[model samples]
Target chain A: MRKIIFLISLAVVSICSVTTLSAQGIQEKSLTLHHGSIKEIHSTLPTCITVANDGSDAIEIVFPANVEPYLEIEIDKRDDILSFDVIDESITHRELNAVLQKNPIRVRMSTAVLSDILNTSDMSITFEDGSVGEWFQVINTGTLFVNGEVLAAKKKIEYYNTGTFTSKIHSYNTTILCLTNTGFLYTNGYTTAKYVEQSSTGIENTDLKVACEKLSISTTGSGVIKYEGTVDDVEIVSTGRAKILTSKLN
Target chain B: MKRLLIFAVSLIVAIAECSAQQSIDELLNREIDSGTTVFKMAVKRDPETGEIIKRVKEFTTTGNKQLAKEFVEAFESERDNVDGWEENRNGGVVQITAVWVNPKRIYTITVAGSALSVFTQTIYREEDKKSK
Candidate 1:
């Protein structure tokens, strides 16, 4: 009797989910990119995530909002190729794959679920490519602190996105001869950008600047910051070679 | 002239040092210019010697089924010495290991929806041991 009751309940749940998915017309999508080369990653899923060449070998990707649980994620590898599939049997594979390749993976889940996915899911690696063969190492060069929260890279391009994002330089004796308008830097999220030196050695001669509303910096190394654009408020903590150009901070 | 010469030498040294420190397999994987980060590859390094033992690359498709299928086709084209492959339906993942005995190299590829990780390692061959 108990077994029969359990089976009936399972059937009812399955039927309800199928009916709900049909009503919403959720689709299945798969995305594939060569493992070695990834350049720019931008999404229009209302949740904007931008990433660049910061060396990270493994990163979790985000799908649209609350659809995390209902969705089935599959990673298929054969030969040397890898395929990422977001399965929603209700939708056609052809249509879903096309959309994912072109834009962000969006699902028509409830807004509440969207909030949960954004807040809980630690999906990362928005962009990747071979511009820097080992961007994972480059990105790990330092720990960026934005308003006391740690920040990870969102998008990496050969050129800086000058007007949109602010990039923090944590490299040793790195020189940006000049900053062009190719691509700028942005925080992991919209927050005050800062740097926390994680290396035992000090960082030196890092020429960096940004155009943002509020900027906070804290570093325990020998590094110099040059602001190339306007800013509203700035706070800095320095230890060894840490200095911000007072003349340019205004 | 002296300063220019010093700068040139320094640049060459720096480039050489960077190349020497990185594994050739990692360099090869890093050279590809595909625009997605879902796929990942790694190498197994010996603990005491710090030498690379093998290389493995793994990737997944999340919204482009055709591209994923095509990529698999392309990858299989270069299967020089695949020892074995297994497909699991539980999560629809695949694990393939290719071994080249002469070169003493091993490649293991694994793909799961949440993770796609591959690794490669070069092993000491029995032939080398027998010759010694």
Candidate 2:
């Protein structure tokens, strides 16, 4: 009877240890949306996220097996809108792929993630709505399309469009570094500073309607910039018949 | 009796200071209505000092121009006590920047063209002065 009691205690200890080890390994979470639209998907740190339209009714996220252990996903529904927040707890960088339906879902991320993914391989994302946050630093070597707001508050958000880049940007206090090779950018927002550097044989057209405190524009080659807003300060350096058009904001 | 009088005065002064200094969250919640949709609110801190350097808040009113107008007016009322205040209006867009000295912070408010969205940011004066 004594030997049997010792054996039973050892078995209980072994089972508890295994259960604790399993809990510390991989953490997976899921939520199925029955109603409401997805308002935003926000990530705490810079993460490599691939969003693709699968034409499904429900939003589904599939994490790669290798990096699944380091991600924490949370969904909050308030006032008939779903807000998805992702926190990346990994010290090392890893790729995350998410497939969802195209309509009524907005994905927000730092432009650094897009730059990282584009550097590794070619990626194209087509969705209904998307937004780029404040800390954006991207050098695009491929086609890029953004049909949403590019917001910056404290630091200057920089983007080097060196490929076929097209965007309808509502910017705030951001400096778009350069636009080269088939770049078409339409901007309308509040800007403290704006720098436009256009070059190459490809025509770069920038239409800006902004309430700007200052604007410093430098254009070369077949580049044209149109401006219409209340600007406190303006500096323009143009070569090769580059046009800068300004009209009063009505 | 003199010591008791001094202690009472000290307690009153401390309470007044505490009531005057309101945090960013408290200030916003008190000024703005709860029905407004809060899009995002984020803060950045100094890594070394663990001091909050910046606070940003974005919200949409869903085409409620009256609410947006009221918010701008509420900030404008405090212009007399601020260190610096400036208001700019270009067509339907309005931008306001105010610098406060007590907490040493700067506030920037922007109301979009349709008055459907508002973005506000508060930055520490020390950080702003350092960048300048």
Candidate 3:
């Protein structure tokens, strides 16, 4: 029988190469929600969770690109509002401990060991709403944005010194906005810059017009970012509110 | 060779008598302000008041009429602990401000065209405010 069709075609090519390597692996999903029970987990890559709560309460874990009907989670009992949807293999763990022996809340979902945004260089963005821009222009180097989104240029810097300027400095505790070398404004705490031509040989003019909500310019040189709201060219900028337009608002 | 030129003039008088008592918190040498242009200076201390709060100096001089006559001879050699002094001239630019009191100090000098710059700031006059 032609060797039984070559052993059933090598067992159907070994079960189609183990179902195509488990559908291109990297899918973790874990769950552990007690205290009223509302658990669910699902992943296809892009996870980083650690919700360890039991004592010393203080637990707030909401992830899924942070809500937007994208797996909505807003549970703060006793004000009476319960909305739920996380059914993926329908509740287990003894039916989530019989619904956490009548709602107590102890969630423990897994699958979030992520850390490979090209091995991270450092990124910190926080804009529950928006605001960042009084004056902005940071030519290049390990991006930094405050008052919410306006940064994304992970790596690709070149300017071996036509006059030095290197980047990889990120330290923000917050005091409003202030990022200079020639751009980024808004500061209502303590701002001081007195570099009257600090040893110039040329090209160090730091042009400024000022007014911002959340600005960060310099896509590549002669930066003159004027904004009223929205003008995509790159580097995170969205959800308006940026002043500083004495002129250039046509 | 005249005893090697008197042993190289006694090794330049023993390195100018070991730098004639250096210290202005040291570091200021191009043979001690020759043509000047020294930058990057420090001497800050105050890890919870260990004193010597500051002394951040920066220098630059391109002759500027000999560093404005050596900064008016370093503000007239700290004229009796200079309690206050100021000089400002427009047009060819020249600025000098001084304030010193024993260990506390602040001296600034600026001159244009041919450039000349200097700043020395240090404060922390304690020791029971020196009997005052």
Interface RMSD for all numbered candidates = 19.3, 19.1, 21.7
> TM-score per model for chain B alone?
0.40, 0.58, 0.35
- Model 2 agreement with the true structure over B82-106: per-residue lDDT tens digits: 6778888888788887765545555
Candidate 2 runs further than 4 Å off: A1-134, A173-202, B1-132
Docking class of 3: incorrect
**RMSD to truth, every model:** 25.6, 23.3, 22.2
lDDT of 3 by residue, B18-37 (tens): 43323322333331222123
- First chain TM-score, candidate 2: 0.45
Q: What tens digits encode model 2's per-residue C-alpha lDDT throughout A1-250?
A: 5432111121222222221112325332322223223333333222233333233334433322333344444433342222222335343323333321111112332222121113211223332323333344444554455443444423445555555555555654455534444343433343445543333344556676664445555454455566666444444444434455543321
Cα lDDT for residue A100, candidate 1: 38
Model 2: native contacts recovered, as a fraction: 0.00
Across residues A141-219, which tens digit of lDDT does each residue of candidate 3 receive?
Answer: 2222223222112221111113223222222222223333332222221112211111122222223222222233222
TM-score of 2: 0.33
TM-score of chain B of 3: 0.35
Best by DockQ: 3
Question: How far out, in Å, is residue A94 in model 2?
Answer: 23
